[model samples]
Target: MRQVKHLLADKGSVVHSVSPAAPVIDAIRMMAEHHVGALIVMDGQRLAGIVSERDYARKVVLKGRSSSATPIAEIMTTEVVTVSPEDSVDHCMRLCTERRVRHLPVVDADRVGGVLSIGDLVKAVISEQTEQIEQLQRYIAG
Candidate 1:
């Protein structure tokens, strides 16, 4: 099974984050500009929470909350699920499904490595399956 490290290697460990004190509008802007669904809320290099487009749509829009006035801390999901570099891709796939989370911040040795989206896990799984299928075909052909 492939590991989170493998995915990160292909995707290039890049984590886009915002301060917890930043406005919801800023977070939204960052997400839009970066073409991401979520942002890791940081409190001076520490993971504070995660703010997603869903959070914005549900918490701020539905609730009629002011995006410019609201802080990320207000709507961010605090109890974030995290993964490590060495963790298996299979585990991450399970976590995303069971936890109903779209993004997981990758942490390694007390440092933030990157963020893994559900897409990344799915791609990794597909790639691994393809490799296995190719190997099987090669053996049968021999």
Candidate 2:
């Protein structure tokens, strides 16, 4: 089974993060610049929480809160679900489905490695399936 380490190797383990004390607007801007839906919220080197567009919509826009005035800590999801690089892609998919989350931070021994979005997992699954299908077809032809 393909592991997260392989995925990280393919995708690169560059973690896009924001300080918990940063204004929501800044996080939003960073997400836009990075073309990501979410960002890891870090307090120094430690992972504090996660802030996503969903959080901004539900907590800021819906509540009529000012993005510039609100800190990411106020809207970020503190109880984040995480995975490790050694974990299988299937395990990550299960976690995502069970937790009803779109993003999972890859952490190992308190070190933040990378973040996986649902799209990443889906693409990986599709690629894996395609390879398997091709292999089966070749085997049958031979």
Candidate 3:
């Protein structure tokens, strides 16, 4: 029953973002510098969309488009799937599986708490499983 809040605490609440109006090249640069695969596209205070390396690969490189000339809004995914801080890791895993999304922004009480990636959910699940296995082993020994 691990929640997103627990997960976010493990990682920090550091959200890397860029403006929708920013060039795709800039967003890519920022992501590379931060060593993140995705960047939250912000329109002022609102979460406009998300731009990812996949988007750049498919929408720009594959399409033979110029990254410097294209705006993030043009390549970003606007229908952002989000999760709550109180949401269960199981629920988040289902969302990721069904929606085929790699990342989800965590929203709590009308505010952005953090972002969760598929990798994060998998890590949490694996850790939970490992802990359960250890507990079972201890019980058997006792």
Could you say which candidate leads in TM-score? 2
lDDT of every model, 2 decimals = 0.94, 0.96, 0.92
lDDT (Cα, tens digit) per residue for candidate 3, span 1-142: 7999999999988999999989999999999999889988888878888999999999999999999999999999999999988899999999999999999999777667788999999999999999999999999999
The runs of at least 3 residues in candidate 3 whose Cα sits more than 4 Å from the true structure, single-residue gaps closed, are none
Candidate 1 per-residue C-alpha lDDT over 1-142 given as tens digits, one digit per residue, 9 for 90 to 100: 9888888999998899999989999999999999999999989978999999999999999999999999999999999999999999999989999999999999988788999999888888888899999999999999
TM-score, per-candidate, Cα-based:
0.97, 0.98, 0.97
Query: Candidate 3 — which pairs collide?
Result: none
> Model 2, 1-142: lDDT tens per residue?
7999999999999999999989999999999999999999999999999999999999999999999999999999999999999999999999999999999999999999999999999999999999999999999999
Model 1: weakest 10-residue lDDT segment is: 119-128
Error of 3 at 4 (Å): 0.3
Better of 1 and 2 by lDDT: 2
Give the lDDT ranking, best first. Answer: 2, 1, 3
